[model samples]
Target chain A: MLRGFLVLVLFFLLGEALQKVFLIPVSGGVLGMMLMTLTLMFKGGISDDLASASQGLISVLVLLIMPGVVGVFFTADQFAGQWLAVAAALLGGTFLSVLSTLWLMSRVVRLGGGKGE
Target chain B: MARVNDWYSRLLSLPETLSASPALAIGLTFGAFFAGNAVFRRIGRPLWLPPVVLSAVLLAAVVALLGMDYKAYQQGAHWLTVLLGPATVALGIPLYQQMHHIRALWRPILVTLPIAATLAAVYALVIAWSLGATPEVLASLAPKSVTAPIAIGITQQLGGSVPLMMGGLLITGVVATLFVDLAARWLAISDDRILGFALGLNGHAVGTARAFEISPTAGAFASLGMGLTGVFTALILPLVFHL
Candidate 1:
């Protein structure tokens, strides 16, 4: 577990460094995820340590994000007078995006003869 | 009489003293989370009442009652948020697990990613624009479909407010989760991969969580969708704005 955590953190730090050095638009964590994915692909498998550690962290992901969500209290002012618009954008956009993605993917599977089905 | 007065004074000052302690913030967040999780389970885990949402609401109320400032709460809570970086990187595990799926459908996955992710952002931006949302709000909303850590980064890059981005992210997750489930049923689509991918692309982490509940295959696809979408949006959105 410790080894897994160490690997993840090292990859994350490396990702951050790459982002800073290369001016990557994606966040370091995301870049790290990509790099790690590539590394795993090349290695052809996952380590037991990495798998368990990653699962442990991913399992509590919601708790990690809760602090940021609480920032809603701070942004209450931003929502003032635009609540309806914000609400519509979030609700309408999410519904539409889900529907579109579902429809498009289903069709892609059919047309391309993809294995997703 | 003096003793009673002294005891009352100590009691009155207790909250202030506790609020000053960073541990109080950390403890409150975890305590609330577990309590929220317990309640969510007890209530049969309603789709709308995710433990995180419940925890956030409960924490907000508790902080208000304690008269604790958000900044003060953040002193301890920030440590937890820091873990999000590692967590985001750890997504590689699940993505790697789906390597077989990727090998089989890389082309379809690639084709679907750009359109789905772009639409996710564009639809929100268009709706918000039509309704007169400010540019900053639009910037924040643009990355709403990605995971929180990635979305936060995109918001900063765009000079949008992180707090506003977070609000949009949370709501988008909840809305996408509910709608995808309903849409899947209404459309008679039972493929877990498609369901999970849509959930991840549109809903992100929250949707990914729900997808996992359906099945591991769904969970893996959700992870793939979320990771790819985050990378794609983070790479593309800023370039589009620069143009």
Candidate 2:
């Protein structure tokens, strides 16, 4: 637990340093994550300090789904009226995304000197 | 303060408005999207009916109509973002579980990681350029498809003047979910492993979830792709942008 808190705090602070001083574009939270990842890599396996600290927090990641869930509170009425546009964007984006990326992915694999067949 | 919040809340909750809670609103929109998806699927329609995209679009529409600031919506969303830490940490657990396979795949992963990362960014830039998007947006969108917090970091550094790369992440997730299977099939990639990883690499969480639906092995690879992509993007994007 101590390790987790310390690491999280440490990473965030360092991230802030990079953000403020160096003006690195990534979020501090991410920098913190990367810092922690590096710590684990160097140390080779989780310490009791690291595991206990990180485990509890990692469990409820799903709760982050709330705010977006909450965004729906105001959108209830608009559902019926603009459902078409919403549907179109959703479907259209999905279609384009799937077709384009799939095609590109195959070409990429082949270009990389690999063949699925 | 509570009273002030309550008064403003009441004003916002007028029948002329939508739901008062962003969380509830989000939950309900997804609920409706599921229903919509059910309707489409029942009729044997295309799988292009995306629940997340549909739900988010529906939410954005109401925000536009009600003149609700993104701030108010995010007030409710702050709860969600706080969970990001735990979510990322959980990634460790799954990663540990798959350690053996990870060891075996390490070589290929190293070689492929940079290539995949570069392609995702380049494609994003290409699309924005084709669409004639503004420079700020192009810059902001470039590092998207990496991961949320990291994307946010890069966006902040670039002075992109936009919300973190999260919005773009969300879009990528929804898109990845819808198309992962199609891509896998199109490539004639017989292995589910490759399909899942590609989707997750390109899509992130949504793709990861889709990978889970396919099988555990695929899900595992997807997770790897997601994690590796974030790390690679962080290290390499700055170098690429500099060049």
Candidate 3:
């Protein structure tokens, strides 16, 4: 588990390094994910240890954002006057996005001869 | 009277310990999340009681009650904050695991995921702008459909408010998780692939979790959607918006 975790950390650091070197706008974590995905694809698969370590970390992924969420909560007063606008935009935008994506994907899959179960 | 004064002094000093030590903050985070998870389980895992949201609320209440400010809480919670990047990198494992399934539908996924993500971003932007939202709020809402870590990056690059971005993400996740099933039923969308993709696209991690509860194939496709959407948004949004 320790080795596996170290590998993940190394990938993350590599991602950060790449981001700095390339002046990319993307986050290091995301670039790390892309790197790991490519590694897994080329390497055939992950070792059991690596797999377990990743699983352990991913399982509590939501917990990692608690601090940020709490930060938002404390500063929520900044948006107090605009709650209505924010709500309308988020609700309308998300609902429409989901609906449109679902509609378009189903159509594309059908046209591609993929069976939809 | 002397005993009451002593208790008051101790209470005042509590923040010094809890809000100054990384270990204590980490412990508090885990303890709060554990309690949230327990409550979620006890409530039969309702859609509204997401463990993250519940834990954040619980933690925030505790912080408020203790008179500890956000900065102090953040200082002590730096350990967990640092792990966010690694945890996001860890998401690659599940995405890698689903590579076979993704490969089979690569064409559709490749074509659809980017469009879906762009559509989501544009929808939020246009709607928020039309609703008279500030540019800051619009920027924050633009990345609301993506996962939190990537969303935060996008928001920062776009000069949006991170707090607003986090709030937008939480709202999107909860709404998608709660409404996807009902909306699907209303729209008569019984196709697992479509349902899964929609969940993943708009809901991110939380939506993907809901997809898993439906079926393994749904879960796999949901992971694909989530991963592809994250990549697409991170790579494209900055360039498209000139951020």
Residue B36, model 3: Cα distance from true site in angstroms:
1.3
Could you tell which candidate, 1 or 2, scores higher by TM-score?
Answer: 1
- Each model: TM-score of chain B? 0.94, 0.77, 0.89
- On residues A5-92, what C-alpha lDDT tens digit does candidate 2 reach at each position? 5765566677657767876655555555556555666666866666666555543332344244334444345334433433333344
Candidate 3's DockQ is 0.67
For all predicted structures, in order, the TM-scores are 0.95, 0.64, 0.92
The candidate, 2 or 3, that scores higher on TM-score is 3
What TM-score would you give candidate 2 relative to the actual structure? 0.64
How badly does each model clash, as a count of residue pairs?
Answer: 0, 18, 0
Categorize the docking of model 1.
medium
- Order candidates by TM-score, high to low: 1, 3, 2
Say which docking band candidate 3 falls in: medium
lDDT of 3 by residue, B25-139 (tens): 7777888889888888988988767877888889888878778777887888878878878877887887788766666666677678878889988887877787788877877
Model 2 stretches astray by more than 4 angstroms: A1-117, B1-46, B61-67, B161-165
Q: Can you write out model 1's per-residue Cα lDDT over B1-243, one digit (the tens) per residue?
A: 999999999887776778676678878889888988999999998997688888888989988887777887887788888889899899888888987876777777778899999999999989998999888888889999999988988888888888888988999999899999899988899988889899889989999988989988888889889988998999899887555
Model 3 alpha-carbon miss at residue B177, Å: 1.8
Full candidate order by lDDT, most accurate first: 1, 3, 2
Candidate 2 lDDT over residue span B4-77, tens digit each: 99999888765235435666445543454565455646667554544445545555665566676666657655
The pairs that clash in candidate 1 are none
Give lDDT: candidate 2, residue B164. Answer: 25
